[model samples]
Target: MAPAITTLAAAPELSAANTGFMLICSALVMLMTPALAFFYGGMVRVKSTLNMLMMSFISLGIVTILWVLYGFSLAFGADSGSIIGWSSDYVGLSGIGVTELWDGYTIPVYVFAVFQLMFAILTPALISGALADRVKFTAWALFIALWVTVVYFPVAHWVWGSGGWLFEMGVIDFAGGTAVHINAGAAALGVILVIGKRVGFKKDPMRPHSLPLVMLGAGLLWFGWFGFNAGSWLGNDDGVGAVMFVNTQVATAAAMLAWLAYEKIRHGSFTTLGAASGAVAGLVAITPAGGSVSPLGAIAVGAIAGLVCAMAVGLKYKFGYDDSLDVIGVHLVGGVIGSLLVGFFATGGVQSDAKGLFYGGGLEQLGKQAIGVFAVLAYSLVASAILALIIDKTMGMRVSEDDEVSGIDQVEHAETAYDFSGAGGGASSRSTAAPAPAVTETKKVDA
Candidate 1:
């Protein structure tokens, strides 16, 4: 999250208004993880539903503990070599006074710490979507612990910390296009590469089990994102946060419409799934660019991200990867689009003076944005792959194929997301289809 830049020659006192607003925002961000769980859970087959939810839910637990221990210090503490940060005082959150304000801001250090903890919680959860229907729970949990320490903490430092290289270089990431989305996206790619595809891969009919649940999750994400975007500025003392709030709404709306339009043209139907995915794409794209772009610029960012991500979700099919729920397509691609577009659409009025190509800023900001984008991407991809490999070599990563085909929820959790055993032979228990005749000829089919 971006802190308000200040030039006051005096010590800043706490403001009840900003602190209350930040607390509410922190709560909002905290809700996004469970929102993500519902979104991902509804997309998988019934047998794997609980497992998908747990993957996202587990991060809230693993990351929170780590963040309290050293994740916060490593991410937001005093910088070292522009690569990482650390402070003995921040360990266990021990030394800071309760009333002490975060540097240059009106909110308390504790408020800022919890607010940032929510972001830390959500970032690793974003990777779970790509590993759906596979991955051992214990292995996945271990991976979150290690990946956040190695990949997320350092990348967050690079993008937002006091002495971070990208921060010093003036690479503008208003929130977490690079640090959160791209970082998680690339890590998803890396881990998926190591774990390989699901057992069925492209063979099974893996459509979402509950579109309504997906829609509900998407709706919650859109609601929570206001805080995710606006609260980055830490306060409403200036109108930049307000501008971010507006940009968030407009961009998300534009993305939904654009994605539906693309779906209608490309697939001849406007699916609810398209609308939900599109809205999320817009949310992802506008995240980093919201503070820098106008509502109109946000529309462009959202629309482009919507159309591009609409097409991108199909890449796993063509490229022979099993990105079970399109995390790489929406988060990775959307993050890059929003980040790069900042180099073109930044108005130089809201966040910083560094303009984009469209504002006659030339290639300077664009070049800087590229460095930030690829730097995070490369490091996360490589580092995450290594972490997953280490876990795979030790405790193993994937469940047995038999367990996977049967169901991960029962195999791993010993429970299921739904139970129809007491339904008195409900529709789910009754067979509705006619028995198929014996096959007479082999036929080639494309899906």
Candidate 2:
């Protein structure tokens, strides 16, 4: 038989520069998930660290299948209604051949599809942090599959899909303020509500297992976020991409400083965890508003989110919700601050038509921003809670009491996060913070 092959030609008018840039941007965004794995993994107790990392890794697998199957079509296909798109036309990437562009965009359909898929993968992984060390791995996987289907796809349609209601209403989500951070954060809250707290939440130390690893993860995320925020423009030859790139850095740095300042004032010392969390908060806050605002605008937004989220982390105790890793505080609260502030700071130079309230646009954009935030928050909260309830009632969302107390890592995965016994033929310890296997009192080996 003749060799079977397929061919692709660049979109005739495609700016090769943009396509190449976005391909790199897509890879950068993909890296953020693994970076997230490390970030969340390092934050949990040592025993559950591996499981935390796996929670993020699994999203890469599950969401990849769903997106290729029907997720993309439902979110981005030809609009059948203002609420959702028609999957029948583009399921598994059928009907539209690879040669076509993504409508008005310069990138090939395949590139845009994959780039957005990175966002889809990262969003669910963001929720895994809040459920650390408590849920069954199987149940967590199932929750991600269902939550993304019911909440993420439809919300993506509402915000970014052509002819979508929110898109038509002119709510500005340059990247994914509503679709990503807030959506995952609210879902995290809902699941925790259904599943209850990790065994010794408030009383437990629950400190970061590896502050160095956490710092590394934060650094990687900060680096990769350039592509995430600026690439939203989908092109850099335009000056707006540069504006966004600078804004991302400025906002993140400012936020970190603000967070550290808060820590020093309230806790009497700065902590590494606070710095990393502050950086992420800044990134989340800038994501939706970076394109619309100036660098100073970004700094203001980032600083506010850093301060607010630093304080919000304490809400778990006051409200008694037990968000194990503070997902609700940073992502949900940061996303809201960034999205709403655009109404106040959007100066109409680099992005968007309508100016912000501070720029003389009045409350029109502010009202729209609030509506978008509340809409996503409400829908995700309700949908996620229902999904969690179904999973908890069916397969059981949480692990057994013994399993939790014994360490969900080995119970769930039959593996230890950091095995040292293998190096010297010593037995593994089952203690919560298991130390290196001891050297037996053996005579020194004759050398």
Candidate 3:
């Protein structure tokens, strides 16, 4: 009798299906940056429109360069302490092989790195909404570079990295309730506090110049968010990603309706702007909890977020902070609602075995969720404020008062979003504001 030779099992191979899916998802997320530009651009007065678009578009450049150089390493590299991470292999994205898998995942390291890069690029752009009309373009760009390096990278490591303190403590953030929305929202608050209010915060009629543009941008954002939420699951290998997709849609719809309902009761109208903003509020709320909660749970989360965030937007005006575009209202408050609701809505059947309070998991998970929320909030608020103060002291953060009043588009970019010089056969550009009613003589009529 002869003994048969035995061979060891092969290591995991590349997954073409997952790789292709992720590449598509990454492209979708990339679209969100430009979508945000339009969404914000349409909300500001016509004079500041181009500046708003540029604020988001510029991040696509600044963060991409930093990510390739060192941002990726600091965020995903081997843990140096509970606070930060570093690895020689991840520097310049040059040390890794193309085919290497990302920490035993089905996709290649390149695919994962690029997908994550899109996140880094989008996070700081979110803050641009808060600084909309008043900030100098150069200062905003510089702030993006410095803020991401000091605030975003470390916070990302804290929530998602293997050895991060929060991750080690079993705090769950399915996507980026903590890392993306809350972090950016808090930063926006901090920076706005340092720079002071817009030129005419209370007296001006700063109605959106183009509601149609806002609607268009909001539609694009809704489409892109499917990729943002579903793709965070990495793959649909176990049907978790599919569940996330369903929950994402459910929550967003509920939120839009809830917001519209609230607006109708309180303000007497269901506005186009309300619909768009409500949809975004829903998307923000589901970002962190979509994978952990069921579709029904998602409805509760969305409705609550829509109601709460709708109320929160009014707080800035009352508190005297000029959050030009409601970034703090929606992202900051929505992130808090979603992150904490995971404690009560988590089902233990989805992403992990963790259960929420309603599922008989008790208050333990709620306590953990609270820790993650407040920790990120407190750190981001304080750190971002200090950064803004330093930048303001050194070179100034706001544009000149004259430039801001005349229009930041011309002074900063030398271009306007719309050119009306040729309108009505006039060589000079006309103000976008509506003109006074024409005076006419009263005529006798059969009365």
Candidate 4:
């Protein structure tokens, strides 16, 4: 009886590597939140830069606490018919100490919990880009808290958690193709539709305020993505190592070339924004298939992602929807492209268990991939629309026109990013003072 009990208590080693590696992966995943802040922050007008940053930053604090409380249970707890977690064993991380056990790993369950927490933080932040500059901060906060609970958690359970329908069906997401990208993309569309367009979305130039800021954000996102994709392996292995290294170079180069080529062809100049946007497009495209495809396939995925997302961004103009920062375009379209392409480019000649078109596996795998994409899209859109309506009715989602024109940074946060020198040179002068003085200074300098 003693020997049997000891054997039952022993958990398999999660990975072959030591705790140091898992710790690093955890840290890498954590960086993605801040990286996302920079990525989204740079896309909006100057008036709402801080607001964008705040959206991403708040997730780090809020979601981490929620994950500890019951978010993990709802997401990864003992599966409840693959729709949600049933067990509350990890609520408040109870019994999840250094000695706690999980599938194939001897590491503390806390490491797994922390890694997943970062993902939860990022998913809601992804939607914030679509609602930038218009939504009330308090309302946005509450909506995110509720959105994760109602939309994100269940989808996560359905895809990644045990007994999930998609999992049971044997869909190959590899790393959140359906769960994260498709889900976020669909929700972004829903929120934008309900929130309505930003003031002068189509008519106004609405240019990105700082190209440098945009590039910086893109760089951080690219860097942090190493953890986002590679860390999903959750262990140090040859496969994970190769995926991490190749994901970095293939995506960087493919996106850079694709964007520049597109810009040169269409606009006659390769703008910095094009470079940054292309990089992100590549990153999004590779996310779903990075683990399954070869390096050459990765390049194909990234290059196509860049071009497809670039074109998809223009859809808002043609269709008359204001996806403020093109979240639907880059994430949704790129995700679809990646998910489908893997059906053709996957190794083993596409005839084996997971063959792609190029591997002679025919179209069966492609059909399966398409099914996964459509399923996630339909479910996320409807659910997100319902959730948005609920929040709108309960707490109000958008700010008034007056507050919007005054700039969300000031109206919402009561702070401004810049205070021009020599313009408000007098004591007691505030930002509200007329710009006539600054205009005069500018004329004098020009002269």
Q: Record all residue pairs in model 3 with backbone atoms less than 3 Å apart, i.e. clashing.
A: none
Question: Which lDDT values do the candidates have, in the order given?
Answer: 0.93, 0.91, 0.92, 0.80
Please give each candidate's TM-score. 0.93, 0.92, 0.93, 0.89
- Using TM-score as the yardstick, the better of models 2 and 4 is 2
lDDT, model 4, position 403 = 83
Query: CA lDDT of 130 in candidate 1?
Result: 95
**Sort by lDDT, top down from the best:** 1, 3, 2, 4
Looking at model 1, report the run of 10 residues with the lowest lDDT sum.
424-433
Per-residue alpha-carbon lDDT of model 4 for 218-292, expressed as tens digits? 888887887777777666654655564586569657966887898899889989888888888888777777766
Residue 177 displacement (Å), model 4: 1.9
Candidate 3 yields a Cα-based lDDT of: 0.92
Candidate 3 lDDT over 49-135, as tens digits, reads: 999999999999999999999999999999978888898888999999989998868899899989888999889999999998899
Q: Which stretches of model 1 miss by more than 4 angstroms? A: 1-8, 424-447
Whose lDDT is higher: candidate 1's or candidate 4's?
1
Candidate 2 Cα misplacement greater than 4 A, ranges = 1-12, 87-89, 423-447
110 in model 2: Cα distance from truth in Å?
A: 0.6
Best by lDDT: 1
* Residues 328-403, model 1: lDDT tens digits: 9999999999999999999899998889999999999999999999999999999999999999998999999999
Tell me which of candidates 3 and 4 scores higher on lDDT. Answer: 3
